[model samples]
Target: MDVSIIETSSLGDRSYLISAGAVGVVVDPQRDIDRVLALARDRGVRITHVLETHIHNDYVTGGLELARTVGAEYVVPAGDDVGYQRRAVGDGDLIDASPILLQVMHTPGHTHHHVSYVLRESNGGIRGVFTGGSMLFGTTGRTDLLGKEHTEELTHAQYHSVRRLAVELPADTKVYPTHGFGSFCAATPASGDSSTVGEQRTTNPALTQDEQSYVDELIAGLSEYPAYYAHMGVINTRGPAPVDLSLPAPVDPDELRRRIEDGEWVVDLRERTAFAAGHLGGTLGFELSDSFVTYLGWLYQWGAPLTLIGENEDQVADARRELVRIGIDDLAGAAVGEIHTLVAGTELRSYRVADFAALSEALREKDTTVLDVRQRNEYAESHIDGAINIPLHELADHLGTLPDGEIWVHCASGYRASIAASMIDRPGRTTVLINDDYDNANDTDITSAT
Candidate 1:
């Protein structure tokens, strides 16, 4: 059997085309269906089945679309949580199609209907399994995805699901999880992909942690998942909308900046961890680790020219390609040199956040106001008190409430606070960003006598 991993960077999801002789089974078909179809057309192979490991929350799924295009059977997890699929396959059920045999395993930790597929080896032995978001490279999927309800129960369920597979599957069964390292699905993810059952047993931290520890640690590490998850979940539930393969040309930098100044939306796509360390102020930060394409489509005001704050030149092409994948072709050229364009105008000065002493002095006046732009949960867990909690996604909504004072912002990692600090619109309000790691964080920032 020939298995090809199709990297659909549209929303940082992976799909597979497993071909045994002439039959093909596409797993977790992401939004970019045309690419997969083109691959099949080029190879002259016919796709017989389209399988979805689960109802994805990150991006739209192309399972139904691929099935429609190829007239293949659309298979989803057993519970029929997704009502549109052509068929539902339960745990331990096997589908024998000529040389291809797929055994479905119901892995419900990621979602109630999430399933993993075990493909038959060339010698008819079960060797590889596609573990979707249920189990990533290093950590497991977030239980809060479905929200606060049943989070603990699902975490418990997830633990058992992983343990069962660890013990039941052969030590050599290769694991292909959907989102690999660098994905926001889990923090502290494995360094690389393609791990074996034996390797996971020996090295995976999740396998050893107690159930409570597993839930707490995993929950703590997850950064804010993109605000676009709801829309993507709906799209995945119904199946993906068609994505036009042809993209528009990249825009010029000058044009892009003008748009940003004219009240247009622009998102900086650098790593959140890096952006928090330091960045140009006033830019709405969209860390690349979050779904760039997904958020680029939703939060992106239609017809607004986009200014990309790329990590580096190598990421420029990827940034452009991702924008195009979501029908956003009007990219106002990326920031020319560094992140300075975010605060390019006259009178808006940049001050580096060094230590608590400097920050305390900055906030010593009656007119100093500190802003916190982390998720609601993160803010509650222990954030600098007296800081207004305007989560980044809701920044625009709560902008009216920000006092016209020296606005100093900070996040756990600093990336978001930089984005938050940059977006403060009040004039004469000196902007500052604390380091993402907060090396100089003063306990007084949270507990000081106000």
Candidate 2:
């Protein structure tokens, strides 16, 4: 049997293509089906089945369309009322695809109806387990995405679900999880990508603790998830549009300006230094990185038209892929050109980037308001003495609460701070970005608060 792990770095989600002989099966596929299809063609295998562990709340799934396109069986969990045609599967159900036999295990924690598929040979020898969000590398999936009301209950379920896997599966069985590796869906940060059932039983924190203790720990560790996540489950249930790889229409400078004037967002996908040097006035600087889709989806208004500005066509294409994952597909057009040339006569905006040492000195000269854009839990743990807490996701809504003066913005690292600076930076109001490593703040002479 052969299994290919396709990692979506932008969202930190993994999909698998498992095959034996000329038949293959896809598990937890993303919206982009081209890559999966190409892999099948390259391997000279026909995709016989598409399986979804649960209704994903992080990104749209292309499983339905992929299955339809390939003339394969679309298997989904029976717990969800996904108004669509599919082979609804439940616990103890067995699926046969030649040499690969999948046994469904109902694991409810990430969702009420989540299931993990245990792969075995025709002779019943355990090979691997596709433990979607139930079991991760060093932790389990966060149970709070559903809502606060379901948090405790789901966490309790997660404890039992993980325990069941450890007891039922062999120690050497490989565990493949969908959420981990920088995904916020994880209960805690994962140490690595893959882990065996034996490793998890010995090292996983959730596995070691009792049900109540595990529930408390999991609930307390969850930070603010993306706002766009709210719509994903519903969208996945209804099914999403087929992946459209065509590039968005190209817009010249005049059209870009016109859209900006019409209250449409002009997102500049460039590095922080390049964005900080000189960018179009009122153009939001969102660096094209793993966190691009996260912040953009959080800040951007739903259904609003957006014009993308990138250094080149490739950068814009990358940004489009990330945007589509979060259901932000209302792309008006894209502007691909040099920043200076595009905004010729207009005055470009820039902010001063400083270190913690500079921030300490600046605070001495005048009373400066420092804005800490980390999550609430992070802020609660420790922060600069006088800094105000306004998580980056909620910064736009709390702009009015900011006191007048030189505002010092920062996050764990420089990434989020750079984004915050671009949002709150103005013509007259000076905003200094403390772009240094957050750990360095602890060494500074400046007092800190918990």
Candidate 3:
């Protein structure tokens, strides 16, 4: 049996296609089922089962639709209160999928009913375990996602869940997790790219630290996740509609301007530098990239009529796929063409993009107002001295309170800063994007840590 990893880097998550002979089983698929279908087709394998580790709290799961498309059995843990029909599995249940056999292990940490599937050969030789959200690369899934009231209890459960996997599974069993590549689902940033049960024994915090210590540290390290996560569980539980990857109907410049004037979301999918150079006044610059979906979903007003302003049709199409992964379907329309043409006689808004070196030099000549758009915890760890900490997500509500002058915006990387700079740019304010890494700030004498 071979395990094929299907990575969705935007959400920092992975889905797996475990195949033996002509049969395959998919675990934790994203909303875009075409990717999984294409993979199965390429491998010449028929999908026999689609298993969801839990009702996901990040992206909408494609498991239900994928199963329906291929006539595969949809398997979910027994205790989740879901709306759809499926094969409800519980702990100690053995699944026979041809040459591949799976044993269910009740791992109640990430969620109350989360389960990990132990993959084995027909002869009972353990190959690996899919520990979704429970045991990640180095840390575990954050316990506060369900709510703060359950954090402590879930943290305790998370500690034991990791311990249970370590003690019960063979030392060499491969570890496959659904979250923690870069997802906020992780309690902390996961380390490295891959690990095994044996490797985790030496490096995983839950394995090395005492249970109480593990729980305490995990809870203490928890930080803010995206606001969009609140809607993911609800959408996943109710069963998400089949995704619409078709391009949104073309929107004319007149209508695009009308939508922007009427206060609808008109997201611009272009490179950060290009967006900084020129963009529509009210359009958000979410540059089509890996981080685009996470930040866009975090700040997006749920259920709002969203329109796309892309440089080309392909860019808008790509953005649509990313948006659908998080359940942002039903795009109002999309306007694609040169920014100048799409402006419809309205002048394009522009901003200056610079690096930390420019910031350091500017500080020498004048008292510059710097805005750090990173998370509060990140700001506490280290930031430029006197830089205002209005995280990008909070910038919209607090934009009016920002001190006047040329506001220099920055984040750990230029991504959030570019977004913030676009939001803060207006009639009289001078917005400069610090398009550089925050570590570069340390090269000067402007950085400080608490």
Candidate 4:
């Protein structure tokens, strides 16, 4: 049996395509089914089942649509109260897939109905297990997504679930998880690219620490995830609309400006430095990069009209795919061209981009208002001595509270800083984008710890 990993690095999740001879099974597919389809086609395998470990809180699942398209059984954990049809499965249920058998094991933690599938050859030899959010590489999935009331209960459950897997499964059995590659669904930052049950026994917190210690650390470590995560679980459980990846309608310069004036989300998808150099007034500089979708979705008002201004059609198309993966479909329109042309007769907005060394020099000369837009935990761990902490997610509401003068904005990386600086730059305020990695700032005299 061969297990293929389909990684969606943007969301820090993985989908599995397990194949044996001509039979194939897909586990936790993303919204874009074409990728999964192509993989199965290339492997020359017939998909017989599509399995979802839980109702995902990070991205829309393609399992239902993929199963419907291929005429395969759609398997969901029993008791999720889903809106669509699926073969609701429970612990110990064995699914026959010819060359391999999938043994379901109920592992509630990530969600109330989460389950893992143990892959076994038809002859009953174990291959590996798809543990979804239950058992990640070195940590477990976050338990607080449901609500504050359920956090403690779920944290305890998560501990027992990982312990159960460690005890029941073979030490050398390969472990595959859907979240924790960088997904906010993880309780903490997961370690390594790959791991086995045996490796986890020595490294995973659930195995090394006692239940109380693990629960305490996990609950305390839980941090804020994307605000868009609230919509993902609902979309997945109620059956997400089929993904439409086709480019949004072409918006002219006039329409783009009108939307921007109307306070709609007209995001510019260029490199941060280029965006800082010149961009349309009132347009958000959400440079097209790995971290773009996560922050954009977090700050975007759900169901609001969103427009994109990209350097070219390909950039807009790339941004659209990333948006759809997180259930941000139905774009208002997009304008693609040089920034100058897109601005029409209006003058483009610009900001200063500099490094930490420049910030250090400026700080030494006089008092400067520094804005650190990283998360609260990140700000607490270490930061510039006198910097203000308004995390990027909460910056919009706190803009008026910032001290007057030229505000210098920064994050761990320059991405969030660029977004914050663009938001801060207006007719009345002077903003500087500290476009450098935060670690480099440690070399200067301004570094401090709380």
C-alpha local distance difference test of each model: 0.68, 0.87, 0.92, 0.92
Model 4, span 195-239: residue lDDT tens: 999999999999999999999999998889999999989999899
Clash count per candidate = 7, 0, 0, 0
Greater lDDT among 2 and 3 belongs to: 3
lDDT by residue for model 1 (285-369), tens: 6666445565456556656766776656557656665654444555656653455544445333354454455666665655556
Per-residue lDDT of candidate 3, residues 320-410 (tens digit): 9999999999899999898899988899889898999999999889999999999999999999999999988999999889988898999
Clashes of 2: 0
Q: What's the true lDDT of residue 121 in model 4?
A: 65
Off by over 4 Å in 4: none
Give candidate 3 regions above 4 Å deviation: none
TM-score of each: 0.70, 0.97, 0.99, 0.99
lDDT digits (tens) for residues 1-450 of candidate 2: 998998998888999999899999999998888889999988889999999999999988989889999999999999798868999999999888887789999999999999999999878799999999998988999999999999889999999999999999999999999888778788888878688999999888778888788888788778888888998999999988777766789998887777766767888899987888887877888899988998888778888788899999999988888888877776889999898778746777787888998888887888888999998888877788888889898888998778776889899888899888888877777878777898888888775666
Please estimate how well model 2 matches the true structure, expressed as its whole-model Cα lDDT: 0.87
Lowest lDDT block of 10, candidate 2? 340-349
In candidate 2, the residue pairs with backbone N, CA or C atoms under 3 Å apart (3 or more residues apart, or in different chains) clash, namely none
